[model samples]
Target: MLKLMKLPTAWGLRNASPFNLKAEALLTMSGQAYESIEALPNKGPKGKLPALIDGEQVIGDSSLIQRHLEDKYEARFDDGLSEVELADAVAYRRMAEEWLYFINLWVRWIECPTITRDAFFSGIPWPLRGLVFGRLQKDVKRTLHGQGLGRHTREEIYGFGEEALAAIAARIGSGPFFFGDTPRSVDAALYPQLLNVAEAPYDTPLREAARKHAVLTDYVRRCDQTIFAAREDLPNVA
Candidate 1:
């Protein structure tokens, strides 16, 4: 059995971090027997959650995890996709994980700091909570700055988010999944990020932007119902 190190579940999501959720979704959809162990980012070799432990080997990063599943376990997430279709799927997944991920960070940590602090940091006690959240927010800002999104105005950030959502909606269109009726690895990558943006408790312009796209919301709902249909016992943050 594989052991997946994950962050705590929160905001009605399998995991508050989209990457963590993505890894879990891939495992679930692949029909793999795995154990989700609640652990911190530092616990993993890469200092990130969603690390998959297969015997003595610990695979870090969601994409790497997918590769491991495919190479080692013969899991076929892109079973029927043509070369061009696979390329397209990869492009969309990169956009979501690289670009939109920063936009989400801005929304959660910068735009709605109170919500994030209260939900994730309140357990630290009063003064320490303030200190810890302050440090974490600073680190996030530095990361975003290095990524170039933090330098933009808040409106510009949210505008980028809206555009990303629109693109995702267009790609998904009327299909049940990114490619068609069959769920692919792209769906696993896309679903959790969409859920984080559309369903998280925080009310930011980014969330509102995600909501405006009916296609995106519907896609999220379907993924939530279908991909995670078997793991209904997963806990949620109250």
Candidate 2:
């Protein structure tokens, strides 16, 4: 069994961090037994979550973890697809992870008018959580600005994000998963971010924009109802 260390679930999400959700989904879809361990924020290699431990080998990053699974455990992670389709999935996966991922961050750490920050900071002690949150918020904002997304207006950002969602929905078509009948490697990367934003508690512009595409909502529900259902080895957060 593989062990994945990541942040605990929060904000009405299973595994508040999308990378964590990606790891869990890959493991589940791969038919591999595994357990989840709650890891500290920005604690793993390159300061991220969902680091996988397989015996003596520790893998970092969601993409790298998926590759490790495919290369070492199951070469069929992207199975059932022609090379061109696999290439397309890889492109969408990158778009979801890099662009949509940051847009969701913008919503949470920048434009959100709700308790997302507080919920995230709840992991820390009472006195220091606020201070830590402020510091981290500044860092996140700086990162977003450097990523070139912070310059856009909220309206622009929401519109930009919705376009990406639309692309994913179209590519998924009427299929149960992105690549057709079965979940693809792209689904592992894309579903988490979509679920996190679309199912967010507040009715913000970003969430509203995401919800406009019926297929996007359905895709997320399908993924959640299928891969993200409760399991015995799931962990309890502090």
Candidate 3:
């Protein structure tokens, strides 16, 4: 069985935080049976969530995990994508990983502070909610600053986010999924970022733009139902 080392379920919505969703999607699409290992302070890699453990080996980072899974289960992981399709898929995936990171930070910090705050509070046990909120706020601040997107105020970020979403939506207009016919690696990479934007507690114009796009809304719903079924259990790494 494949053992996924991941964070608590509540943190799953965080942007680069789609590690869990991607891992779950890969597992489900491949029809593989796997166990999950909750990564711990001393036991796992120093960075991020949704690490993978297969037998005695541990893999960290989503992209690396995907590669590892593909190598391990060659037939199952193979999408049989063509060369041009594969190139397009990888390009979009890169955009999702790199560009969406900033978009996510902007949304969480400047754009939807209230929603993030509430989400932070709700994620913790009642007793630790206060402490968790404080830590999360500080952490978010540091992350935003580190990413350089934190320099912009909410309004500025919102403007930028709107343009970004418009561009994405335009690209997506070319087909049902980013790749047209099938859900490719690009769809896997981009979907979660859009999902976070759509579902986040903010009623900003950017989110409104997302809501207006019928294709994006349908894509998100389909990804949620197909790749991330509500009942699927994730690794309980705390």
Candidate 4:
């Protein structure tokens, strides 16, 4: 049996972490079964969620996990696409995981608003949860600062996130998936973040911007229905 380490679930997704969701999506796309369990913040290689263990092989990072699966199975996510198209798919995958991911983090941590903060605090056990959570928040703030989003105003941050969403929406363009017909690895990486922005209970400027795009929201639902519907942790379609 295979196991995945990830965060607690929020909304209807398997996990709140985009990388974890991506790994799960990749696994779903691979037609493989794996179980997910909680991972401490610093567990696994590189201290990240979405690590995978198959027998003695321990792989960390969503991208690394993707590579491992492809190598072990000798399969390709963009199986039917041309070389150029596969290259395009990989490009979008990086944009979603590398660029869009940071923007989503700004809305969650930097904006902190109330719902997200409360959710974070609720994850900690009391007595020490407050102190530990506060320290964690501070560390995240510094990380965002070093990453450059912390320097921007709230509106600026939302605007940046919106731009990334717009690029995604534009690329999708009424297609069933990013590349049309079949979904590539990037679709697996993308669905969770767009779903997060669109369906999160708390109001956010990023959500507002995302809601304006029917295509993107529709795509999220489609992915959820296709890849996530059978899981026990899956939620009702939104």
Highest lDDT: give the candidate number: 1
C-alpha positional error of residue 64 in candidate 2 after TM-score superposition, expressed in Å = 0.8
37 Cα displacement, candidate 4 (Å): 1.7
Superpose all Cα atoms of candidate 4 onto the true structure and report the RMSD in Å to 1 decimal.
2.9
Clash count list over all predictions: 0, 0, 0, 0
lDDT tens string, model 2, 150-218?
989878998888889888878888878887777777887888889888887756877887888888889
Q: Ranking by lDDT, best first?
A: 1, 2, 4, 3
- Model 4: clashing residue pairs? none
Pairs of residues at least 3 apart in sequence or in different chains that clash in candidate 2:
none
List the candidate 2 regions with Cα displacement exceeding 4 Å: 123-127, 228-238
Residue-level lDDT of model 4, residues 153-232, one tens digit each, is 87788778889889889999988988887767878888887887788775877888899999999999888777765565
lDDT of 4 at 168: 88
lDDT of 3 by residue, 1-238 (tens): 7887655444355332465667766665555667665453345574667777888887877777778767877624436767887786776677666666576766766556666666545756766876766676677788778877777776776677777677777788856777666665566667877887776656777778788887777887776665545335544322
Give a tens-digit lDDT track for model 1, residues 108-168.
Answer: 8998899998888767998989998999899999999999999999788888999999999
Better of 3 and 4 by TM-score: 4
TM-score of each: 0.95, 0.91, 0.78, 0.90
Q: How close is candidate 4 to the true structure, as a TM-score?
A: 0.90
- C-alpha local distance difference test of each model: 0.88, 0.80, 0.66, 0.77
